[model samples]
Target: MKQVQKIKLGISIGDLNGIGSEIVLKTFDDSRMLDFCTPVIFASAKIITFLKKQYKLSLNFQGIDDPSKAIDGKINVMNVWKENVNINFGEEDPEVGKYAFLSLEAATAALKNDDIDVLVTAPINKSSIQSENFNFPGHTDYLARELEGESLMFMITDTLKIGLLTDHVALKDIASVITPELIQKKIDIIHETLKQDFRIQKPKIAVLGINPHSGDNGVIGKEDEEILKPTLHKIREKGKLVYGPYSADSFFGSKNYKNFDAVVASYHDQGLIPFKTLSFGNGVNFTAGLNKVRTSPDHGTAFEIAGTNSANINSFKEAVFKAIEIYKCRKEYRKLTQNALKKQGRKDTNKKLFTKDN
Candidate 1:
C-alpha cells in the first residue's frame, strides 16, 4: 500500500487526575505512531511528567506553544495552560475539572481553525467536567455544539460499527424520543457517514427496535411497527439499502450484525451494551456526521485505576488510527467527486460544440 500524507492529530487530555495523560503518552511512546501522523497533545508538560512519575513509565515528548510548531516523529505537548493544579488521583475535584476544560477548550478551538486535521480526545469524567462553561453529557454533545453538526455517536472497530439514535438520555425518555422522524434522520446521518467517512459506495445499515423481540407485531410495543417500519421503508424507497427493526436480543446474539455495514440502535445502551460487550478493549467512539473529524476511546475516565499503569491503550490507539483513516477517506471522496464533476462539465461542453457544428 502507498503511504498517504501524515495527519496532525490534536488530542485533548480528558481529566487531569484520570488516565487521560497515561494513555496518550503510552500510545505515542512508540515512535512508529509518528510515521502515520503528527501528535499534538493539548496538555501541560508538568501534568504529563507527574503522571509518568506516578505510573513509573519513562516517556519523552517535545513541548510546543502552537500547533504549527509541532514536530513530526516526536510526541508534541501543546501547553494549553500554565496552572499549577494538583492531581488528585482517584478523586474528582473541581480544580482538576477546570484544567480539563481548559485543555479541551483550546484543542477544540485549534480544530475549528483547521490547525489540526483530526481530534482524538481522551476519556473525561462527565460529572467532574461539568461546569458553567462546559455543561454537557460528554465529548459527543460538546463536539456537536462546538462544530455545529448533528453528530452521531458511532462505535467502530475492525468489524461491525454501531450508532445510537438517542444518546445520553434516560431509559424512561427513550420511548418518547423514538419517533419516525428522528429514526430516519439518524439513519440518514449514519448512511452519509458510512459513505464519506468509510468510503463505502452503497452502505447497508441495520436498525434495532426499541422493544424486545422487535415489538412482536405490536405485542411488545407499537413503536417498531407504527414508526420504525415505515421509516425504514421510506429510506429504502429513496435508493438506500436499510434493513431491520431487528430484536436487540437476537441481533447480536446471533451475530446478524456481521452482514450489515453499520447498525443503528433506538437508544444508547441498546447499542453500546452490545458493542462494548463484544469489542470493548479495541473499540472507538467516533463522532460521525461532523464537519470535522473527531474520535475517542470506547471507555471513560477509569478513576478506579487512574494511575495503576493498568489502563489498556488499544482503544485509544484505534481511535487515533480511525481518525486518520476517516480524514484520508473524506479527502479522497471529495477529490473523486470533484474529478467526476469536471469530467461531466467537459463532456457537456463538447456535446454542445458538436451539435452547433452539425
Candidate 2:
C-alpha cells in the first residue's frame, strides 16, 4: 500500500442547536487545523451558512458528496442530511438530534472503513437525542456499541489522566462493578494503549480505592480490602508498576497524582471529578481502546450559548491536537520498531556468515 500524504479526519458536527456547530466552525475556520489533517465535516451546508451568518464566524465552506473529495486548506462539509431542517439557535428540537445522529453515523462508517485516520466528534445533547434508534448517553456509550464493546473512557490532560471503570451509571450500582478482574482489565487496556498510542514505556499506574480511607481495611467498606487491593497485588505480580487503594480525598492533594503516569478510579466521579476540576473547558476525553480512534472535547454541548459566538473553542482545539499527537506517536513507534528489526536482522546475518567461514 502507498503512504497517504494527508491525515483524513472525519469531524461530526454535533447537535445544531447546541454550540457544536459554532465550535466546529471556529476550529476549522483557522487555517492551522488544515496543517495537521484534512477535516471532512459530516453536517449540513445550510446549517453552516446559518452559523456563519448568525455568529459572524469567518469560515469558508465547500460541500462534498464523498469523503475522498475533501480538500486541504479548506473546510469540507458533507451533507449527510439530505433535507435541511429549520435550525433554532439554542433550542433543542428533535431535528437537531436526528441530524446529529446521522452525522455521527456517517462519520463512523467512514472511520470503520479506514476512509479517515481519526474522528473528532462535537457535542451531542442526551435529552433531545431520544429516538428509538438513538438512545446513547453520549459518544462514549454510542461508540462502544458501534465498535462492539472494546473500549474504555478516560478524561485526559497534561496532568492527572483518569480512567473510569464505570461511566454514567447510578452511584449506588458503582460498587457492584468494582471487581478485581475489571480493574485488572482496565489497567491492562490503559497500559497497552499508553504504550501503543502515547509511546509510554513501563507506564507507572495508580489505582484509586472505592471507599474513603480505602475501606480502612473493611472498617469503611469491604470492596476496597476484598476486591481492589487484591487486584493491585495481582497486577504488581505480573511485573507491572501498579499502586494504590489510596483515598480519593487526599489523592489530589499536593499534586501527588503527577507522580504516576495514569490513575484508575473504581467509578465515574472518583476519576472525572478531579479531571474536570483541573482541566475544565480545556480537557480532551479519549476513548482509549477502540480499534477505530475516537476523541471529543471534554466539555458538553453548551445549548445556552449555542450560536451566540460566545463558546470557547479551546477544548475542541485540544481534542484535534491530541488526535494528531496520538497519530504521530503511533507512527513513530512503528518506525522505531521496524528499524530495530532491520538492525537485528543485519546483526544475525553477520554472525551466521562469520560462523560458516570459521
Candidate 3:
C-alpha cells in the first residue's frame, strides 16, 4: 500500500490564561491523530507541562526547537519564547496577551514561509490580545494584513457553511457596509473558495437579506431590493450560481439552507447567531480567500472555564482536521487546474501550427 503524505499542522496558542493550551493538549492526546498529520504547536513547553500536571491528563508530546525537526509520531511544541509568563487561569493579563501575539506571529510567519501546510488557531481574547503590534479586531484581520489578500470569514460545520458579508463590524454600521459592490466582491471570493478550497465543482450559494422579512419587499428597508437583490441578479448573470435575499428569520428555520452549499449573511450576527446555536461546540471558522490556510474553533476564549479543565476539545479538533482537509483539497485543485491549462495550451499550439501549414 502506498503511504499517504502527512501534512504538518502549525498551531498558534491563544491567550495562555484561557483554554488554548488545554484544548490543544486534549485534541492531540489521542495518538491516532498523529497518523493523519504532524502537529507543531507554537507555545512554550513549560506551559504545556503545567497544564498537563494541573489537569492530570496523561498525554505524551515532544518539544522541538525547530519545526523542520518535528516528527510524525508525536505532538511537537516549538518554543516561541523561553520566558515563564505567569498563567492566571481566569484573569486577563498583559503578559499572557504578549505571549499570545508572539506565538501567533511566529506561526503565521512559518505558514507564509511554507514551513507548515496549515494553521489551527486556538481561541484568543479579542480585548486582551491587543497591543502596539497587534491592533486588529481579531485573527482574521491580522492574518489578512500579513498575507495580503481579502479575508472572507467562513463559518463551517458538517451540516452547514456560512460566510459573512461584513465581519467584526458594528451592527449600526452594517447597512452602510452592505453595498452592492461589497456584496459582489464577497460573493466572488466565496464562490472561488468553495470551488477550490472545498472541492465543489459548481457551488450554489444563498445570500441572506439585510433586514427582517427581506425588507418585506421594501416595506421595512430598501437595502434588500435596492442593493442585495440587484447584486444577486448581477452575480447570477455572470454564470455564477447564487440566489436570494432570503429573510434571515425564516431561512434557517424553514431549513432552506439545506438546499445550498453556503449561506452569505449581510452581517455577523445574522449569520453567526444561528450558526453558533446550531453548531456552537463544533463549528470551524475558516478564513477564506487568503494565500494561507487558517482555521479556528468557532467559540471564543471561554474565560470562565479556563483553568477548570472542562473545555470541550471538539471544536478545536474539528478546526485542525478542517484545515488539513482544505489544504489537501487546494493542492489537488491546483494540480488539476494546472494540468488542464497545460493541455489547453498544447491544443492551442496545434491549432495555430495547422492553420499556418494549411
Question: Highest TM-score, which number?
Answer: 3
**What's the ranking of the predictions by TM-score, best on top?**
3, 1, 2
lDDT of 1 by residue, 13-66 (tens): 999778888898888878788889999999888777777687777668877899
Model 1, residue 319: displacement in angstroms? Answer: 0.8
lDDT of each: 0.89, 0.84, 0.91
lDDT of the structure predicted as candidate 1: 0.89
Model 2 weakest lDDT span, ten residues long: 147-156
Off-target runs (Cα >4 Å) in candidate 1 are: 1-5, 355-358
lDDT, model 3 = 0.91
lDDT per residue as tens, model 2, 227-302? 8888789889999998987789899976879999998887888888888888888899999877767889998888
Q: By lDDT, who's the top model here? A: 3
Q: Model 3 over residues 1-358: C-alpha lDDT tens digits?
A: 9866589999999998888888988888888889889999999788788888988878888888888788877888998887788889988887789899999999999898888889999989888889999999999999999996799999999789999999999988999988878998899999999999998999999999899989998999888888899889989999999999888999999999999999999899999999999999889999999988999998888899998989999999999999989998998999999999999999999999999999
lDDT at 264, model 1: 92
| Candidate 1, pairs of clashing residues | none
Every candidate's CA RMSD: 2.1, 2.8, 1.3
